[model samples]
Target: MKVTLKLPKPRNPLVAPARARKAGAHASYNPARKVRRTEKHKLNQALSGRKTEGSYDA
Candidate 1:
């Protein structure tokens, strides 16, 4: 016997969720993005041997 299922197509993730009732999970509301961006910025600065105003090292 063969079984099959029909599912809705995947949704776009980059657009805002509430705007025009867009599909996909909320990409903008994620709190981790800011944290990751900041962390990556610091890490990049550290790797490039650039001094920042903050006391961040390593």
Candidate 2:
């Protein structure tokens, strides 16, 4: 019996960085959609309850 192995195609690395930059630019332009102090505090508090670490880092 003979067996053949197949390799996956390589990804286009350039596409990813370009897409990330575009997303970052769009997020920067839309200031209102950004998270506010109250929302952030609530999110942190909710996460603290579930996570033993108590806070999200970086």
Give the TM-score of each candidate.
0.41, 0.30
After TM-score superposition, what is the CA distance of residue 11 in candidate 1 from its true location, in Å?
A: 31
Show model 1 residue runs off by greater than 4 Å.
1-26, 52-54
Candidate with maximal lDDT: 1
- Model 1 sits at a Cα RMSD from the real structure of 11.6
lDDT of 2 by residue, 1-58 (tens): 8998898999998998888773535446555555576557667777768634545544
What number of clashing residue pairs does each candidate have, in the order they appear? 0, 0
Model 1: how far is 56 from its true place, Å?
2.0
Output the lDDT of residue 13, model 2: 83
Sequence-dependent TM-score of model 1: 0.41
Worst ten-residue run, lDDT, model 2? 22-31
Give the C-alpha lDDT of model 1.
0.76
lDDT of 2 at 17: 85
Stretches > 4 Å off in candidate 2 = 1-3, 23-58
